[model samples]
Target: MSTTVTPTIKHTALSDFKEITKMRLSLSVVFSSVAGYFLGADTISLKIVLLLALGGYFMVGASNAFNQIIEKDLDALMHRTKNRPVASGRMTVNTAFLIACVFTILGIGILYSINAQTAMFGAISIFLYTSVYTPLKTKTPLSVFVGAIPGAIPFMLGWVAATDNFGIEPGTLFALQFFWQFPHFWAIGWFLFEDYKRGGFFMLPTGKQDKGTAVQIILYTVWTILVSIVPVFGVTGQLKLSIVAAIIVLSLGLVMLYYAIQLYKKMTEKAAKQLMLSSVLYITLIQIVYVIDKFIR
Candidate 1:
């Protein structure tokens, strides 16, 4: 006799969690956290590292989820974002909200297990990113500046989680990431200006893609390079970078600046895309350099 068997259906809700949180973006955030943790801890603990990664992912995921919820309408209007789960009707706003709440609470709890200061910073990051920066994106270009504060927090949050205090070391990490975001994001803004315009998002400080904006991008790129190399002087306390590492990092920065200048000279979509790609390479390489220098020094 053959017996009939039925397979249990997996709920779609599980899939929605991954989609809404932008798991890839959350992973990138966690990478920075892990890097900071390694740099801050003399002896790395796997448990602390795991906790930091989990807490960082939850906080960043919650922020991304809430961002999608608030920008659902605007997202629907942009080709790049039109298919987002919330914007595309794959998930309801109520479902997104619940997920965001759960992620935020879980993230804070995990960080609190590490340290109260880390938990506090994690909460602040979510609140600022979701409540202030996300809405401000449509209102003014300064929103990027507002967003940078929360965006830069993760790198330093790991330090605080490991050490349970805010000091010169974490401050340097924060400044480095904070300055880096301007060029990285403005390159993206330049390339996606039309799409952002369609969504009523003011990403460029000049409101239009012009020489002024390009010049600002170049200026920030220079500033990012300066701050990134400062650790070479051995003045940033625990955040010191060796001479060789500084040279390698500076070279990377100059290459990124070259792309930024190219974009500025042409002010075309293709050039902007190149600049954006270069910016990504710049941030990633510098972070890796910092990690390598920490171990080799």
Candidate 2:
């Protein structure tokens, strides 16, 4: 009985840690950084890739942990987030704070070993996320814009880690992600508007699922698609994309655009959910295409 209980308790603790870190989301963020690293690196070094992935994960985890700590009560109010470790009362604030601190220290330290610039960007991302974005969630719809800064950093952060420089190439990578997030998040905000409202979050541009919000989503989705193909125009420095890759990327964007249009025309929860999932697939596939094109070209 004692042995079984001990194992169960340990398992629960492990699960709580995963929840606090938002492990799946953190891994996805790390994937962006790794892809950027590959794109920017002249010669791939497994050591740098490993360092970037680990440090990137730690930084994203710290931001999520801090966000949970800050929004514990608000999270409890929302049905979607109510079961979170902190919001559910299964994890104490102090424990979560300790984990956040450890992650922050280790993350920055590891990134610093890569380059001062990489560490600086990582620190900025965490600061913006936990300090500005978390607080502004309930205040203004502009919070999404502010949040996009940190959210867009991982891809560029990889380029910086690989090259130790901030240039047109990394900037292009940053712009592509920055624009993509608006439509992705707006789609989510559309479908989950009520759940977010329960938590006092005003995520949509119009604060309601209206034509005004749908138009902005469509506009930003177009902007994202355009930025994704700009590399083919030979204007984005070292970030050149082959014509074939650009066409594939354009096709992927069109698929997302179709869903965005469906949401606008239908204005139903189902359409919004479809757009949300399509946006996820779009970003993931676009990143993969960019990396593969670089290596094969």
Candidate 3:
């Protein structure tokens, strides 16, 4: 009985840790950073890749843990977030805070080993996410815009880690992710409107799902597609894209745009969810396409 209970306790603790850190979200963030690193790297170094992955994960995890800590009360009010470790009382606030502190130290230390710029960006991402964006969630819809800053940093952070220089290459990577977030997040806001409201969060640009919000989603999707193809024009320095890759990316973007347009026409929760899912696929596929093109071109 004692042995069986010990394993159960350990499993529960691990599950709680994953919940507080938002494991899946943190991993996706790490993927973006590693993809950027590959694009910027002249010759892939396994050590750098490992560092970027671990450091990026730790940093994102720390940011999310802090976000949960601040939003514990708010999270408790939302059905979607109610089961989170802190929100559900599965973990103490002090324990969560300690985990965040350790992750912060480890993330920054690991990134500093890569380069100062990478570490600096990681630190800034944490600060902006926890101190600014998290707080603004309950206050304004514009928090999505502010949140995009840190959200976009990981992609560019990888390039900086590889090159140790910030330029049009990294800048373009940043712009790509930055613009992409608006439509992606707003679609989520549209579908989860009621849940967000339960938490006192105003995430949509129009503060309600309407034609105005749909138009903004369509507009941003267009902008995201445009930014994605700009590297094919050869203006982005080391970040050039082949025509074949650009066409593939354009096709993917158009597919996502189709979903965005559907949301506009239907203005239904189902359409909004489709747009949100498409946005996720768009970002992931484009990152894969871009990295593959860099190698083949």
Model 2: lDDT of residue 248: 99
The TM-score measured for candidate 1 stands at 0.94
Q: Indicate the worst ten consecutive residues by lDDT in candidate 3.
A: 2-11
- What is the clash count of model 1? 0
Each candidate's number of clashing pairs is 0, 0, 0
Q: RMSD of model 1, in Å?
A: 6.0
In model 1, what lDDT does residue 270 have? 90
lDDT of 1 at 264: 86
What lDDT does each candidate get? 0.90, 0.95, 0.95
Better of 1 and 3 by lDDT: 3
Q: Candidate 1 residues 199-255, lDDT tens each?
A: 999999899889999999999999989988988887888888989999999999999
Task: Give candidate 1's whole-model lDDT.
Answer: 0.90
Q: Lowest lDDT 10-mer window, candidate 1?
A: 8-17
Q: Residues 1-297, candidate 2, lDDT per residue (tens digit)?
A: 355434333338888899899999999999999999999999999999999999999999999999999999999999999888999899999999999999999999999999999999999999999999999999999999999999999999999999999999999999999999899999999999999999999999999999999999999999999999999999988888999999999999999999999999999989999999999999999999999999898
Error of 3 at 232 (Å): 0.6
